[model samples]
Target: MSESIDIVYEALGRYIDGLCGSTYIGTARGMVVLYRGAEIHHLTPLKEPLPFLNLFYRKGTVEIVGVWREEKSEAFFLRAAAADVRLFEDERTISIITYPRTGDMQERGMLIITLHANMGMAKTLKSIIQEETRFIKKEEVVISSRVSI
Candidate 1:
């Protein structure tokens, strides 16, 4: 049997809107890439970002963290919000795959995610995503994030 996957696209779009001087979150769906090996995958049949955000939201706040690319362990906790999640040569992308503390069979397949930003906001968003480049494992990474910077 093939399992269904819930994809996140709009929240990141909204977040990008917020960054782009929009008072309201626009309807544009954010750009996200999911891939296996060198073949990029598309996220079809789009869904709202609320359900996905709800998974990590707590106490009226949600924390975004980046997992070290070399980490092979399947178990982990959301210890803290990462200062930056960018893990690509292109400054516009931010990796969003985090390791869960429990290896729930149901919560499978967050393998690789990288978010690409709009070219216009590249300068503004780059600083927020800036981090040490050595931690990035580009060749094997799949990326996802807001569509800014």
Candidate 2:
């Protein structure tokens, strides 16, 4: 892993150690999932969609919706789907935002996490969108000014 990715993954490792449930970390290349306590899974994106039980949509600001999951023999895999994998070809992305699923929510949604890889400097987080239960949306300017690249 690169230095920046190491830093981010290190921080995320600490966070995941304390979570009681599963959490996913997506990158431009693939996904790293922490299931329960110490079970970790690395998954690659599937070109075609599968018959997944829990389907969700991954969308970016560019309006491209990518298929994000695949299931085979009762195992699940995830990909950082954004319509096209190449959309993040030049960027090093680490997903930091996601909406919590609720029973009453009509549709599943994902928040955009776009990061530009600037090896030794901090990258800017752009176009973060959050939706409320009342249908109100709040957009933040920058999530963190110190996200190392």
Instruction: Name the best candidate (by TM-score).
Output: 1
TM-score list, all predictions: 0.27, 0.23
TM-score (C-alpha) between model 1 and the true structure: 0.27
Give RMSD (Å) of candidate 1 vs. truth.
Answer: 13.0
Local distance difference test scores for all models? 0.29, 0.26
Runs off by more than 4 Å, candidate 2? 1-28, 45-91, 97-128, 131-149
Quote the positional error of residue 148 for candidate 1 in Å: 26
Candidate 1, pairs of clashing residues = 76-100, 76-101, 112-142, 113-142, 113-143, 113-144, 114-143, 114-144, 115-144, 115-145
Q: Give one digit per residue, the lDDT tens place, for model 1 in 34-99.
A: 333355443321333311211132222213222211212111112112232333435544345433
Please list the residue runs of candidate 1 whose C-alpha ends up more than 4 Å from where it truly belongs after superposition.
1-29, 33-84, 87-108, 111-117, 131-149
lDDT of 2 at 19: 35
Report the C-alpha displacement of residue 118, candidate 1, in angstroms: 3.9
Q: Which digits, one per residue and each the tens of the lDDT, describe model 2 over residues 14-57?
A: 33432323222222322322222243222223233322211122
- On lDDT, the candidate that comes out on top is 1
